[model samples]
Target: MSGPLRLIELRPSPNNIKVRLGLRLKGCEFETIPVALDDAERAEVLRLSGQPLTPVLLDGDLPVWDSAAILRHLDTIAPHEPIFFGRTRERIHEVERWERWARGVVYDTFTIVPGMAFRGAFDPAEVERANAEMRRHTARIEEALADRDYLLGDAPTAADLTLVPMVFSTMLTEEQAAASRIAAFLRQHFHLGEERDRTRAWVERLMAHWH
Candidate 1:
């Protein structure tokens, strides 16, 4: 909090997107340094975070790795505009629960499936399984949003920021798809469909409001 924040990232990564959204939500002005999967960039990342991972946040001289950890750091630095809504103990736990689910369930599908597709190891059955898993997950999101505009309430919290980008990958616009092969792959394979009406609408609403 004492120095200008710096986010080391791969631009198209959903985890990186979550950190960016968290920073914006907290009204923090920061600089983003985009990195690639190359030897030089990997060494830089390892030096900064002790691991070669994108989305390493330099908070002053403190390097915080992992998207969730970075978001928690944001809340610590900017408590007034918390990523966890209300700043209550209960709300913190609730938001953390959602973050875990997002990382475990939603993030896994987006990462594994896309990694396979991008590697040219694509299998129709694998994609079908991933798509089915997505539908199941989105159905849960739909039910969660049944009585609220956002995941925890009317305002977007870390939970929403964490999940939205991963979900958005599945429903990317033509322009978004054209820009990123990973996005194109996700759009081609994962279909949210009309069944997840509320979840689909919620993703669109958050994209318009936040992005």
Candidate 2:
């Protein structure tokens, strides 16, 4: 009778996972339109959103693209259970700081590994370079998780959800996500727990509806 909240997701992309995690957190149900993300579909998405990126959320006439923007949009619809903020502003800042580090350094470094590993045409030297970059970031994260149960505090936050796709996918081939401190952090804190259920459900739902 009614259309699902249309969410366009690009497969094989951590950016798409970011919004999927966000929507799962909000408990927002949506119809996913799986976009192939090949040259043709990428151009189509670019024409629609003015960029060739993944995880574009379109509700009625409103268009929300980018993982961060989608997350923010969800927050507006459901603010009581805030993902980015907590009881205090400091808490929000802390989450933002870690989230920035995740995407900027950790995810940026570790994100490329799985793609290279899975792609048939990948160069061995490039994969080695990616692994080295990821190892360095993993060590950093392992140190960060030495004491904290999660990235922000005892509870998982926006930062944790955002970081999961990249970290989890990196270890998709049964390898450790990172090295030294950051690797330990991912294994101990990120590998399991509630977020896993949420993310799994999201992917399953997408598969069922988006296809």
Candidate 3:
């Protein structure tokens, strides 16, 4: 608590972004140390967390691994502001559920598809499969947003933290990132239209936090 939290992460990692958003939502001060997902840096991460992964949070002498653990640790120490997991048990369960879904389904789709597409190293069938998976995950998100402002309710929670970064991943090109603002970007990339108006609005509202 004496100094800023040290967050070691990969710049484009959704997992890292989840922790970053959690910190921001709680109004915690932290500094980011970004490393490439290359051999040397991966080794360095292993040295720090005993795992070859990013988004490791250092709380003074203590090191926390993964976004889920980092957010829980932050709540334990920085208990004065927005509660990342929500105050109620049901809300907490819902938030955690969506967070896991984000990691497993949403993150996988966005990362696998774009990573393969941009690299151009995957077979055409693999590309199609990736896109189809992405669509399935996205439909789930759209349906979730149909009746609520946020994933859980009116307020943003850790679920938003987890999913938003995956949305960021879909902004593959520099032009896509720069030219299209949040709603437009979501619309274009997700192939959303009037049918997904609520989801589009939710994205725009979420963008207000950082953009």
What is candidate 2's lDDT per residue for 1-211, written digit by digit as tens? 0234678887556778777766665667787777864456586677666776777887765768877777767777667564554557888688788778877887666644444433534465755676666556555555555566555555556676666666554433224434333343334323322323334333343333211
Candidate 3 stretches with Cα past 4 Å from truth are: 39-41, 117-120, 176-194, 207-211
Name model 2 segments beyond 4 Å from true.
1-4, 39-50, 85-87, 111-125, 146-149, 173-211
Clashing pairs in 3: none
* Candidate models: Cα lDDT each: 0.80, 0.60, 0.68
Q: Between prediction 1 and prediction 2, which has the larger TM-score?
A: 1
TM-score of each: 0.89, 0.68, 0.78
Task: Give the lDDT of residue 209 in candidate 1.
Answer: 38
lDDT of 1 by residue, 80-185 (tens): 7545544778998898899889988787787767887669788888788878888888888999999998898878788898899888887887888887667787
Clashes of each: 0, 7, 0
Which candidate number would show the highest TM-score if scored against the true structure?
1
Candidate 3: global Cα-lDDT? 0.68
Query: lDDT per residue, candidate 3, 1-211, as tens digits?
Result: 6456888887655777678777777778777777865556487777777887788987876789978888878878887556778777887898889888888877666665445434545566755665567666667778888888877776777888778776645434456455324323333344332355666566666655542
Lowest lDDT 10-mer window, candidate 2? 202-211
Candidate 2 lDDT at 188 equals: 34
